[model samples]
Target chain A: MSENIKNWLLFILTVAVVILLSYLANSIINRKAESQFAYTPQIEIGAHEPRNVVWGKNFPRQYESFMRTRDTSFATYLNGSKLRDALGEDPRLVVLWAGYGFSKDYNQPRGHAYAIEDIHNTLRTGGPTGPGTGPMPSTCWTCKSPDVPRTMAEKGIGEFYKGKWADKGSEVVNPIGCADCHNPETMSLQISRPALVEAYENMGKDIKDATHQEMRSLVCAQCHVEYYFDKNIAGQEGVPYLTFPWKYGTTVEDMEKYYDQMEFADWTHPLSKAPMLKAQHPGYELFTTGVHSQRGVSCADCHMPYQSEGGQKFTDHHIRSPLDNVANSCQVCHREESGALINDVFQRQKKIKQTQLSLEELLIRAHIEAQKAWQLGATEAQMKSILMDIRHAQWRWDYSVASHGGTFHSPVEASRIVSTATEIAQEARVKLARLLGQLGFSGEVAYPDISTKAKAQAFIGLDMDKLNDEKETFLKDLVPVWKKEAAEREAQMPIRPVSSRE
Target chain B: MRFSSLKKKLLPPPQWRRPVIILLGIGAGLAIYIAHIANVGSYLTDDPTACVNCHVMTPQFITWRHSSHREVATCNDCHVPQDNFIKKYFFKAKDGLYHSTIFTLRKEPQAIVMHEAGQEAVQSNCIRCHISQVTDPRTAAGVSNHAENRLDRTCWSCHRNVPHGRERSLSSVGFHLEPLPVATRKGSFVPAWLDAQVNHTSN
Candidate 1:
């Protein structure tokens, strides 16, 4: 117990403890590594196997997790796995999409597992009386099933898109699944849809050059982005070739330019009589302009965060809204509390929706005003500029709102798009007012009573009862036959078993 | 100010260089000795023992010990590439360097995670081992499985909870570099909203 001797003894004890702890750490990590490497090939998996059950036999952990996408319990403010009646919630949509099939019925997208079922149930596809009776083209099934790629491979891509929607009902049975975003050979993320590859090629960027992190979002871009069918691409004539109008860029203005160059219109607006552009869900396109994407955050970062079960880690396959799993999705990068993050999303969506609804109302009024101008013997020359204004304004509006999660994905961009749309719509209304005055109708044009979906449908001249009756017949008669045929075909495909070591 | 001037004046002479050199050499030698004892380089191999060199890997080790694959394979069997020696060891070296650096800096997360590369390796390994059971006969007849032709399917995307059971509860046990702040630790997930936003009709 000299003071110097005691200090030396303390230093020695500290060193000894550090060495012991290091040894203990090594022991623990070694043991864990042993457990993780243990594998017994329980089942043999084949190349390009579409059936999930076969893959599940060997990778039961991953398969079981993937199967959880079937659960529809989770929901967020704007979008989730829940099957929401989007058209029912906002009757203005019925008027906005007056001539489009979406006006009949549109539902919020649900989990990947329900892709096939939801498409079948939706009225947009219509009730078919026979193989080619459905209103939709075969191109409609592009994003809904893995069977699409399978069928395209068996029959050529052009041939696949040649028939009607129900023509290949028996062929396309499996819902969006494993084969849609991963390669069976390497199990690496790959873009399955040709449209996405071709879109990238148009932008002079090869998808093959995409980094691993970029592939995460690109795989989702395969189905989530806005697309259209073009029957004019050389050698693919008369086949509704799936194409993304992203040659210029992903911005609303950029896509508008692309469409304008082609003199393309999805349909002439029923009331406005303008060449209208229909904006499909442009999730990936708008998302690319968002803060998250700009900061290099991939869709999978939020929607498919890694989850641990029994010490094994894998990406959560239940892809849905980031808001549904704020802790793993947003909070992993954002330190804000769950309530705060959810509130942030809601606040953005609420504000965007306010402007969205106002723009919708204005467009509705503009369309009606144009119709009134026509009735009053307004010349085509007088109405041409007004119609173009209506088209551009509504296109901007639809572009912002149709992105589904654009508000949360990129609040500033969504706000700017809506603002531009609102200004254009007001200008169109003002022009409409002047035209009405010139035509000798000085008084205000009365707005149609479209307070409800049914009222809106009626105002737009849609016979909902007739549409529903036909849909019912299709579902009851043709649907069962399609399902039965699909089941029988799948049943005929045998699953080979693996021999277990004794 | 006087204390600082006095300290400067009391500093070692410019000619006394041998002691300084010896001290610096000893310091560098000790650092190397410590790193060696830690087995930092061992992680760059197809050895399960290398993974358990870190204390944080205890939960994974315990689970795998009791897993169905315990008797048949080891960690490198699924988590690393088997294509060629160079590629496999290269990945192992990259991963090992990253893990060592993070742990040394005390920057490891509470739970371990597998990145995209690790996921691909595990997925490919799954298909590689169980090739016979999952392949469809139609593929040989020129009807390719959509996954085979494109990058769209992985065995784990569906059979996630197999090999091991529930992971969240299992991973939450045993490993920690330091006690986590109670506020940030995993708790019963409470919703920010009582009903989903999808259920609401915006005004």
Candidate 2:
């Protein structure tokens, strides 16, 4: 064949093959789109169904993935899915929260699946003999279960809050699950917690106006953000109303101002005599000020990344630290190797932890100094300023470190909060030193040897032996009964089975 | 008119471009020849070995070789549609194009996840292949009930590790990719122009 004819033939063949492939590809894409949209749903989920098993019948993929949260094998440097005793790791926390329930016991939070079980096991709740006897209010159960929303719907919201933690044991059976965040009808993320909506209203912002991306984080904020039980809200008299102190804002100073305005003190510091504030897990609040949040990354973006199974893409509902799934979580956006990304998180945590320890040591000294001043017969007038300083300083420290992932979430902001707290602690100690000098005791008040949790608890007058025995009894006796009652109650609830289509 | 004149001026003479065109044609032919030698055309067949051409697919290929379905099916049996000739080839062609694009770009993620389209095809194939077992009265009642009420339960949704057991480490099979010398991989490796812009903002 002539060169011209040969070239023309070759070009024609190439073009023809390309066109054939293109047509094939286009048809396949169309078929795929059609098939995806035409799926016949297998089960109908009821509105506000708290039982995950019912929802799982419809979304077997999502539900099966969600059940993986029960696997407590993963662990990282600072945080992971494993159940860890936080107090056992850091005895300084006992001194830091001397008068609070947290000082009795605190565990590093595990996965969402363990939320209910962890709450039951924590010694902070104490061994309540019966209803209305526990130190914790019914509001304490607000974050632990999807059943909280169900109970609130069945009973009046006001009536739900008008009880003690022990009273709601059998009622809040199911751990945090689908109904806590998702609307059953559409499976869209929704804030079921009224406290979050009320907090939004307090800030003159309607949560309804929040974008879809914002809802990803807000659903987490339902339980993860800092909140307190307000027993004094108008018309909710004597009921422990769950409230987020975010009206001023979510920043440490913003929340301090809000708390100061309300004159709210969680409890008096036993050592310092300061009207102290205890920080709940401020994960959402701290995360909002983070670089990821600033760049529009939601809590779910890391904690609940999308996973592909078989051929379906759905949210992985096992809510745990991003550190555990660095490849899926951080490495999706970051180009770093898995080890490198993990190292980055660990380094940030390490740096923050160094400062956190220093702040804790300083606060311990301030509390001891304040105790010395009181012992030396310093007037209430003389100690008032010191007490306020201690309260503010400890509040800042607690706010910085209490938010589980705050250090890595916003290292710069976490550092700033800790530094300010350190300064306040030093200032408190300095004033306490002057008071001690004035009262004719000029020598240094030696730091207590609280190098262990047992030692620290002893220093703080916590009878650990009695507490542990009581907890053992409670777990052995009461927990089984509660489980039986809950199982029986759930068994009574009818599961509306879908009629078969011929 | 001015733009067309500029374009003409920028173009080389037809006779002068003949050698360059010939060289380009030779390069294209060589690439096609290499691809054919690699058995790229065999991907259109039911042979599962065709899926193992790239180094990235080594783990998957090895796992699938030992999988329970190895005797009964190939990769296409689950992954590609088998509804009809046109639909089957169409699905294969679309996936082939996507796989080639991602491979050529060197943008394969560490963990390979099936796309939504691939998932649907797999789900459909599962139902088609195991129709009797799936539609057994006891099993069908639960699954069909779910399908009637909410969304059809894709078989692989519960059996995630069926075809591949669980994805073993790529390193275990002596599979690794040489690191790409991309600027985005590290800030220090960025081009002078980008580095200048970055530093300029800082200054």
Candidate 3:
């Protein structure tokens, strides 16, 4: 080749490379700008802002999505945003919880938007006409709203958990919102609740070192996980403080060991007279054992996936079942057809449900047989081991069932838990049968007619009519007043406009 | 018309031109060959292929490939420090020596874990990238987070999946790379620059 031709080619090549470099640089700058949107604040959001309507002005997309939690149209095979009376579906729950408040009523929670409303409606919270009147402690308000953090910060964490459920009625009006899991100033995921922080401290772990991705799940863990009212916290005695029993560890057996060591009992079964343990929803603990969590999927990854609106991307706040929006939740990683994925979840759930039902049947029979033994004048010594078995079996049953979505979150673990409970229940029934035979009672101590929720409640000796009447009056009289007082307080803390200040 | 006349008056002498071109050709050829042999191109991009550059990392790579993080992050984004280039490469070299020595000695257990230094790197990187999450003014005094013990725990204490899947083992992952029930295990070691050569549509 000629030297002149070679020189020309080199010059052309250099110019081409220069052009490519500039294009690449321009795109890099553009991409950076794209990711970091020019976030012009409309208002200065306070660190403890509880009213989501105030936060809504700053982030319309997220607020809008959060507001979508109000939608009750969606339903899955078992549960969803839609309301389904849990006791109606499964009357056995009433008999299982016999002496507990859950026997009065058990309604499936609608969604986050109805947190405050649902608490007022549910019979479990009981009918309190005013402060210091309800069966539950003020700690029950811990997970219902952003108002909880605000009240806790304002009137000390311990003080916030000091009284009855009605004590903070007027103070905490807002439902679960932005502030419950976010630092309003930075909009970063923050642990607003003291219980989760205290729980971590008890376990010799710190919450601050949790990564953003971990925070995604941990925020939900704050409310969704199993917790108990510890009336024996040092220096804060008799407060019924909301506390996670993770001191021993997070496993069902580990928590059982902790409760057993402490000799804690939620309530004594009236018929069987066995000390019982009620399992609160342990969604986070069960979820941790699942395959998705092990592979680094956060709660938000599935429940609140990143959604794009127009040109902007934000985490969808309308948290509900993955089945409701299979395209966003399941199809994000799963290449399988949506139907197949839904079927897979349903299949696991159905199999777990089968074992759960078997355990419940065994438990009911054991409880009735124990009652017959008591009627036959059996001594406490005779029934001690049998009651312990009942307690153990019921704990396993409640643990398996109370871990919401246990079947899908970690199917093998959920199924394992239920099967173990079945075995325990069977063991309890076998003991009960032996005890009954010795007490001069014969085969099959006539199972109580608990076919319907009403029948179950009646058998359990719960006057639903009186309970409903009291709840109705409280809702009609006190709830409106609570709303009014909350409104007056919120009105005083108006959001200051940033642009208007200038 | 402009460059040829200007080159004649200025620039390199004709005798030196051939040697310069020859040297440039050999240098380019040698650089490309080294990069090809060392798989250096894979290191530059956010591909999992660079992770399995050593055979010991194959299990880790496969698990990560199937992870939800498979889309958002590369190996270095979590496993290496992100503060500055000097510190990053420095940390990498130091950590690499320890890693190479261990793997060379076949010291990795069935379950691989991050060393203290690696853990520090990962924790700092997590906070660095997730600055928005950790930048809570409420935690300024650390009073809310129990003051002295704020950073005593690491992210992976709860987030085991960030390192690798808890269930998957070296023996569990086969060489065939077939689709598994856990994760699809769909990814490649090919760098973005050479993507066209392999028709690499997926990242």
Candidate 4:
């Protein structure tokens, strides 16, 4: 009886150990599979594929989240993903940009999915009824789509930027998508635009040395940076070449010094006639000065944070304001409740806006003051120093505001720039007072009645009625043809299913 | 006989008493020496220079001095609790202890950002001073939370540049001599003398 009992116990213990071993082996295998980011290819993505639908077949989750860029419901205190009529909101901007194309119609940019459509619809494109009709160069399409890189590869960089913006309308039909910032094969972050590489080259640094983390922000910097159309490159004359003014540095003072030395102007202000500089979106440069960047946080760290969906971890692609998802973005690093974090951002923005608005008022007066100086028979010699001051003052103001997130990114820097601009503008007024006395008319130049967008535009002598009429015709007649042509061309490409599973 | 009696009463035997007196005297002297070296007394006053005694705070002091609030306020006014005497000293003592430990260990992070207790004091001070500006309906934090769990808003979240410039990094640590830094290194992070002393002691 004792022998039987011992045998039974031994048998049961062996069985239990075998079961536990199998369970451990199964878990190990499952974890290995998950770590591989396992996915089977649905269709082979072409090396130069620009159509997002082709990539979507293999990456449904990423593509679906990316498509949420179509949503325009979100708005914030100052800016948003909505198609906001900026000039309508603040007429003073119309006078500030006087002779620039932005003055014609400057809408705060909508979602990235609307990139191609919005550019085609804006009046600033100047009614491209047929090819080569718009005022802007083909360089305007540089940031609009992945198709730009593909087109540049085929047509060559200088030639890609040689023609009018409308000339490439049929070709750049797709809005910004996957190929703009990714390697097709490995899906690693990559810079598709040559301008960014060239800018880095000019800065005496190699873009190749950037780490995977740095590449996350560098990809966004490829488009969201201050750039100019350098028309006088040694071999690429009249190409309206895209160039970043970083030879000196990325600061306002540095870029201003570079532009002044080169005698480059975006457009001559018709009202003030000061050689003007349009501050393009310098989002990346301004952000580097903030506490976020100093703490080694990348743009994607906040803008495209990691999301786990269906047991798979990937960067969330529905990029918009951080205020929209403060829990996932700001709250990840900041322990302050969402309300506290947002209140902080709004406070900084509102405070900066107060000084910015004051700068705008001062700028309007200076322009009118200079205009008065010119009208009262002030000679070019006398107006030279005064015009330089206006240019410097206005450049500071634009640099602070045009970066869009500068107030939140680096409020101290923005505040300092605006406050200094105010001082320079007051000095311009002081010099104007002296100059006007010599010209024999010193009565305070009557402030123009620019109480509304229409009045402001009219004060700046813009023919908004004609511009709107042309825009209507362009959108109704030409845009559809371009879209249809692009669709037909894309449909011809073949996408075969790969018979392999990873 | 009188002289011998006076000597016996006034002074103890040299062997044991001398050493005992010496040990207690050394202990008290060392305590006062540390107190003087740490500039502990300055922390009790409203002087901004007391902060820069730690070289890590040089940048914040320089930035504050150049700010618009330089004429009006000092570091303690915004950072220290001001409800009453007891709470104020208690908070300072706790904070100073933590800071000294971190600095001595060379374990401070690059950013040197504030934590909960520091944040609470600053928030209360901001609301106290700028009550009118904060109470404005347009900028005020409303009672509604939209189902989101969060604490109420603080002023510095918006007014980031108040008295101190926005920088909070070790890289911003300037080498200003005035106000007399308690500790300064000329070459590497650990001064040559300190490195030599450490090696000698370890050996």
Q: Rate the local accuracy (lDDT) of all candidates.
A: 0.75, 0.76, 0.77, 0.78
Q: Over the stretch A1-502, how does candidate 1's per-residue lDDT look in tens digits? A: 8979986996698668666656645644564454433332345444455677666676566577678788887777777877888888899999989999989999888788788888888889988887887898989988988677667666667778888998988788787877777555334555666777778768776566676567778888988888788878777778788888988988999888898898888999988799998988898988998989998888988888866655555577777777777777888678988999899889999999898999999999999899999999999899998998889998889888888888988899999999998999999999989989999998877888888888988988998888889888988898889889988888877666545323
Please give, for residues A340-368, the per-residue lDDT of candidate 3 as tens digits: 99999989988888888888989998888
* TM-score of each candidate structure, all chains considered together: 0.68, 0.67, 0.69, 0.67
Q: Per-residue alpha-carbon lDDT of model 4 for B26-136, expressed as tens digits?
A: 656655655665667998888887776665665677566544465456788788898898988899989988986676555878667889999999888876777676566
Among residues 3 or more apart in sequence or in different chains, the pairs in candidate 4 whose N, CA or C atoms overlap within 3 Å are A344-B157, A348-B158
lDDT against true structure, model 3: 0.77
- Model 4 alpha-carbon drift over 4 Å, by segment: A1-38, A500-502, B1-203
Name the better of 1 and 2 by DockQ. Answer: 1
lDDT digits (tens) for residues A376-453 of candidate 2: 898889999999899999999998888988998989999999999999999988998888999998898999999888
Per-residue lDDT tens digits of candidate 4, residues A230-304? 888767767788888887778888889999999998988887799988998988888887888887788987887
Error of 2 at A24 (Å): 27
User: Any runs in candidate 1 off by more than 4 Å, and if so which?
Assistant: A1-41, A498-502, B1-203
For candidate 1, the lDDT comes to 0.75
Instruction: Output the better candidate (1/3) by DockQ.
Output: 1
Report the error of model 4 at residue B93, Å.
Answer: 53
Ordering by TM-score: 3, 1, 2, 4
lDDT of 1 by residue, B1-203 (tens): 99989987655467756775775576566556666766657765555656766656655654554344654667898988888899898888787778766765657776567888998998788877877656655564566555564247666667765455456332443322112111122211111111111111110
